[model samples]
Each structure stands twice: as structure tokens, then as C-alpha cells.
Target: MKKIKTPISDEEISELQIGDKILLSGVMYTGRDAALPQLVELIKKGKTPINTNGIAIMHTAVSDAGIAPTTSNKEEIESTIPFLSENGVKIHIGKGMLNDETKKALNKNNSIFVITPPVAALLTNNVLEKECVAFENEGIEALYKLKVENIPGIVAIAHGKSI
Candidate 1:
């Protein structure tokens, strides 16, 4: 396993390969299906509050208790992945297989996908701090900014030259 610190660059992303175990530390954001579409809509309206460039987004609605990876196969999330990548999101942390189109988008956009294990308590402990950033009405599906330390995961997909 490799230990990776956040604010990751394209060069660091290129070094990762599918199936490589990783422990990531630093800042990451959390957003589920509800928040993702909202983000895309905000971007389209030119009102995006956050600059996603080079950021990693974990697929979950975070709470003080913990966070768990959500499945990516849902239509809402699956469709949002491409748009998110196009908008400069570099790392996606979630559980389950991403659709082929999303995978293609990741490769085309030089982005990667990491699969978080299904261990909520462990993941929670890794979260040093969390704060809701947007869509407060969505409750658990709200966007969150998180400071994490040694969060465990594995690369499910890597940014490649070709799909």
C-alpha cells in the first residue's frame, strides 16, 4: 500500500494503477447523488461555489458518527460522474462498479476512481473534521468538506491514455 497526501496533482494521479492499495490523507469532499446534480446545475448556471479542480470527492453524505461509501451504479450518480470529471474533479471515492461511460469519461479526463471499504466506523475515525458545505436541506446528502487522515481505499480505476 502507498500513503498519499491530498492536494494531489496530475503527476501523482498518473503514478496510480488499478488495484493499488492506498491510504489517503488531507482534504476531501463528500457528496451523494443529491448534491452532485446540484453541483452540475450550479456549474451550468455559472454559480458554482466551489472550485473542483484537482479535488477528490468521496461518495457519501457525511455525519459526525461516520461515513460509508455509496454505490455508484444508480442512474443519478452514474450520469453525474462524467460531468463531475469534466468539471475538473480528479478522484472519486465510492463503492461498486462505475458504468462504462463514466469509466470512459474518467480516462478521457485524466481522473481516477477509488473504492472505499464498507467500514463506516473505521472511515469515521479517519475523518479528523467535517463540515457541511452546501445543500443543507438535503441532510445526509449534503456536500461536506472533510479533513481526513490515512483513509484506506484501493484504486478501482486509473486515468489511462485509452479506455
Candidate 2:
């Protein structure tokens, strides 16, 4: 089992393994398909609805049925990667493989892509024993899994900003 703090940096975003365990603590928002495109537009227009720096923005559309995770929900065609990187979003959490365009953006943006299964999200939320927004990189995935890492999942947290 491993731990990471949320709202990380471009440097800390790298270095993660497939079967590593993660626990995130920080006020996080869910960005469904409906919201992502608009958010991307905001990034392009020189603005953002929420603070992207060092934050975990998962890509799961929450429905009355709960967070419905889609494999090919948001590709570069729908929302470009530059939008996300330009806005300083440190991480994107979700399942499914990222398109090559998305991968390029992630690498360029210096944002880590921490994956978690849809079912484990709620449970991972429960076992969040600590808060770590600044960052921690315990291991690096030599063979980075293109697909989502199931079971032993990933977590990242925020260290709260001053009021």
C-alpha cells in the first residue's frame, strides 16, 4: 500500500506504478463529459472555474445512478489536451486508455495520470487516512499501463489553502 497527497506538481506527477495503492484527501470535484468540454474552453479562454493547480479532477460523469465511467468518453477530438495543460491541472483520474493526443498533452503538461476503477473510487474515498496535496512519488511504472489500474488503485489529496 502507498499514499500520495493531492494537488501535486508537474514534477511529482510522474512516477507511479500499475498496482500501487493510493489514497487522496482534498476537496475534489467531479467533471463529467458534460462539464469537461466547457472547462476546456475555459482553459482556452484564459480562465478556469476551479483551481487546477495540484488538484485531482477525475473524468467520471456522475448520474443519479452514480459516477458512470465511460472508456472513450472524452477524446482529444472533443476536448483538446492543451486546454488541460495550459490551465495547470496537475492530474486526471480515470479508467480507459488515453488517446495518443491525450498522452502527448499529459507528457507535455507534466501532469500525472492516476487511474482508479470506478467501483474503488467510493471505497478509496473511505480509506483516505491522510491528506497529501503537495506530493509523493514512491515508484515509477516502468511499463506504464495504458489502461486503468484496477484494485490496488491510486489516490491524491490537497493540503488545503488558506482562507
Candidate 3:
């Protein structure tokens, strides 16, 4: 398995291939249906809370229950992927297949999609720290920033290729 650290570099993204297993460490963001579009709007307005460059965003919600992969193909989530990728989000972590346009967008922007296991225990064990970075009124669905180590995932899409 490849061990990757964030913010991942362009060279690292280029080297990844679909189906490659990876252990990701360092910082990552989390968002789901309610928060991602708000983040995109924040970026467009030049008021983003976090620097998105070369960062990884996981499609999940954090709560006392734990964390797990959410369906990334949801309209609210998928619609923001291209824009986020263009704005320098190097990796997107989630579950489910994405559309062709999203695949093309990721390739064009040198970004990739990774899918983690849906098991919450596995994911929560890897999280070292977390904070609500935006949309806190959304509660657990709010955007969060997490510091993690060795979070496991597989490259589901890279360079216009999917597995």
C-alpha cells in the first residue's frame, strides 16, 4: 500500500492509479450535503475559511456516533466536486461512483477520488483531532477539519480512469 500525506503534491496525485490502496495521513476536511456548496460559495466570494490548495475532503459527517463514508454521488455533493477540484482540492474521499463529467474534471485539475471503508470504527480510530470549521449550525453535518493518520482508502478514480 502507498502511504500518502496531505496536502498531497501534484506529483503524488499524478503517480496514483485507480485501485491502488493507500494510507493517508495529515489534515483533511469533511463535508456532506449541507456544507460543501456553502464552501464553494465562500470560495467564490473570496471568504473561504480554510485554504483548499492541495487538500483532501472526505464526504462524511462527524458526530459522537463516529465517522463513515457517505454517498458522494448525491446531487449536492457531486455538483461541488468539479468546482472544488478546480479550486485545488487534490483528493476527494467518499463512497459510490461519480459521473463522467466529474471524472473529467478531476483529471483536468490533477485531482483524484478515493473511497474509504464504510466502517466507522476503522475511520474514527484514525482521527487524531477534529474541529468545526464552518456551518456549525448544521450540527454534525457541518464542515469539519480533521487531523488523521493512516486513514485507509483506495484510489477509485484517477487521471480519468475508474475502478
Candidate 4:
């Protein structure tokens, strides 16, 4: 498996191909339906709370139950992919296929989509630290910052290619 650390460089992203397994380390962020839209709005208004450049974002919620991949193709989540990629989010972690438009956007922005295993226990063990970074009122659905090590995933989409 390939090993990656964030904020992942464009060079690092360029080398990835669909179906390559990866062990991701360093900081990642979490967001799903409730928090992702708010983040997009924050970016549009030039009020972004965190720098997105070359960072990874997982489509999931953090709770006592642990974290696992959420359906990224959901309307609210999929709709944000392009804008988020435009804003420098290089790696999107989740499961499921995205539309053609989203794939083109990722290629244009030098971003990629990764699919993690659905096992929550496996994911939780990789998380070294976690904190809610925004939209706390959304509770478990809030945007969160995570420090992780060796969180495993496979590259499902990169540079206009999908697996």
C-alpha cells in the first residue's frame, strides 16, 4: 500500500491512480450532509474557518459509535465536491460513485476521491485526536478536525478516472 501524509502535495496526488490502496496519515477533516453545506457557504462568503489547501476530508460523522464512510453520492454531499475541490481540498474520503461533472471538477482541481472501508472500529483505531471545528450545534454531524495515522483507503477516483 502507498502511504500518504497531509496536506498532500499536488505531486503526491498526481502519482495516484484508481484502485491503489493507501494508508493516510496526518490531519483530516470530517463532514457530511449537515456540516458540508455550511462549510461551502462559509467559503463563498470568504469566511472559511480552516485552510483547505491540499487537505483531506472524510464524509462521516464522529460519535461514540466511531467513524465510518457515509454515502458521498447523496445530493447535499455530492453537490459540494466541486466547490470543495475548487477551494483546495485535494482528497475526499467516502464511499460510492460520483457524477461525471464531479469527476471533471476533481481533475481540474488536481483532487481525488478515496473510499475507506466501512468498518468503524478499524477507522476509530487510526484516529489519534479529534475535535469539532465548526457547526457544533449539529452535534455528531458537525465538521471536525482529526489527526490520524495509517487510516486505510483505496483511490476510487483520480484525474478523471474512476474504479
Candidate 5:
């Protein structure tokens, strides 16, 4: 397994390969489909709450109940992935296969996409803390900020390449 600390560098990302085991530590932002577009708009307006550069974006909105990787196949949100990449998102964590558009975006942007196993309870154990950061009215679909440790995943696609 490869252990990676966040604010991940290009060299670090380049070293990853499809199916490689990963244990990621540090901070990752959370957002589901509802908050994704808002985040993109925030970036466009130059008013984003946090710098996305070298950071991972996990697909999930949270509540006290905890989190599990959300479906990555949401057509509305998946289409905007490349835009997120252009704005500095480096890692995307979710479940399921990505569409062609998202694949192309990942390729063009040097980002890595990971697929977490469908073990919500196990996944939640990795999260040290989480808080709603934006779009609270969206409820579970609100944006969240999470501090995670030893979060396990597999590289489904890495730096424009995939298994």
C-alpha cells in the first residue's frame, strides 16, 4: 500500500497506478451533487471558501449519521468534474465507473480518481471529524469539511491513466 499525505504533489500522484492500494491522510472536502455546482460557481466568482489545489474532493454530503462514498455517475455533477479539475481539484473519491467526459477531464487535468469500497461503516471510521461548511440548507447535500486518517481506497484512474 502507498501512504500519501495531503497537499499531494505532482510527483506523488504520478507514482500511483490503477488498482494500487492507498491510505490517505489529511484534509478532504465533501460535497454531493447538490453542492458541487455551487462550488464550481464559487470558484468562478473567485469566492471559494477553501483553496482546492492539491486537495481531494470526496463525493458525499454529511450529517451526524456519517458518510459513505456517493455515486459518481450523477450526470449533472460528473460533467462539471473537468471544470473542478481546472480550478485545482486533484483527487476525486467516489464509487462506480466514470463516464467518458469525466475520464477525459481526468486525463487533461492530471487528476486521480479513486473508488472506495462500499463499506460505509468502515469508511466512516477513517473520518476523524467532519462539519458542514457550505449550503447547509441543502441538508445532507451540503458541503462538508473533513479531516480523515488512513482512509483506504484504490486508484481507479491516475494522472490521466486508468486500469
Candidate 6:
């Protein structure tokens, strides 16, 4: 039972490949579908109200009846991810698979998408604990530091490859 941190550096992420297990020991912020548009809009205007680079993981999630399950998620991570990645932000944590576009973006931008094991929710329950997690507007929240592996990605296809 080990806790993984987030908000790693490019060098650290570089040490890791498409599929490698490693621990992330850092703070993360939770925000998802309903919240992404605002973030993107802000970034479009060159106004990032919140500095995402501080937190290790920018979780696209929400809380419900005392439970946090990631709802509808998207890979259109521009404003935030692209700008954040350009600004040195580390990881983009989300549930399910990222579109080929995001995978390409992350790979091109030098970031990694650490997937959480969907089958084992309670199994990693210990990850949520008295870790003293904090964020703007959301205040104090419990987070599970998951050390996960990644999958292969391709942003563009070659001459013979079809989308």
C-alpha cells in the first residue's frame, strides 16, 4: 500500500515511458467537464486565475453524496493542458481513455496521462486519507495518490495509416 504523488517534473516524467509504474507524491486539484470550459476560456484570454503548475494532478472529477467519481470527461485539454504543459505543469489525471488528440498533445508536450484502475475503487480506498489536501473554492478534500501505468499513444498517422 504505497501512496503516489503528482506534479512531477519533465525530467522525472521523461524517466518514465508509455507503460511504467511509479509513485506520485504531490497535491492535486479536482475539476472536470463543467469546469473545463471556464479554464479554457480563461487561458484563451491569457488569464490563468489558478496556477495549475503547483498541483501534481489536475483531476477532472466531482463529488457526489460524499463520493468522487469522474463524470463525462474530454480530451480537449487545450487552454489548460497545452498552456499548462507549455508553462511546466506536469500531469493530467482522468478516468477512461483520452482521445488520440490528447495522447498526441501529451506526448508532444512532454506530459503523461496516468490512468486509474477503474475496476478497483475501494481497493485503492486507502489512497484517500488524512493527507491534508487543499484547493481553491473546494477547500480541504481527500485524495487518493495512485501510482499507475500508461498506454501507447499516437497523435498522427503516417502515409499508410488511417485515423
Candidate 6: clashing pairs of residues:
4-24, 5-24, 5-25, 5-26, 6-56, 7-56
Show the lowest summed lDDT stretch of 10 residues, model 3. 60-69
Per-model C-alpha lDDT, please? 0.86, 0.49, 0.97, 0.97, 0.84, 0.45
Model 5, residue 142: C-alpha shift (Å)? 0.9
Candidate scoring better on TM-score of 2 and 5: 5
Candidate 1 local lDDT, 1-163, one digit each (tens): 8988877878888899988899999989988889988988998899987888888899987776689899977777778889888888888998887767888899988889999888899999898888887899999899898999999988988865221
Candidate 6 accuracy as lDDT: 0.45
Task: TM-score each candidate.
Answer: 0.94, 0.63, 0.99, 0.99, 0.94, 0.59
Query: Model 5 segments beyond 4 Å from truth?
Result: none
Which has the better lDDT: candidate 5, or candidate 6?
5
- lDDT at 13 for candidate 4? 99
C-alpha lDDT (0 to 100) for residue 7 of candidate 2: 57
Instruction: Write candidate 3's Cα lDDT for 1-163 as tens digits.
Output: 9999999999999999999999999999999999999999999999999999999999999998889989999999999999999999999999999999999999999999999999999899999999999999999999999999999999999998999
Model 2, clash count? 7
Model 5 residue 55 lDDT? 90
Question: Residue 14 in candidate 2 has what lDDT?
Answer: 57
Tens-place lDDT digits, model 4, residues 1-163: 9999999999999999999999999999999999999999999999999999999999999998899999999999999999999999999999998999999999999999999999999999999999999999999999999999999999999988999
Estimate the TM-score for candidate 4.
0.99
Error of 6 at 2 (Å): 9.2
* TM-score of candidate 6 relative to the true fold: 0.59
User: How many residue pairs clash per model?
Assistant: 0, 7, 0, 0, 0, 6
Error of 6 at 133 (Å): 12
RMSD of each: 1.9, 12.0, 0.5, 0.5, 1.2, 6.8
lDDT of 2 by residue, 8-93 (tens): 65555555544446755554445544566666776568665567776656655433343433443355322543466657767566
lDDT of 2 at 131: 27
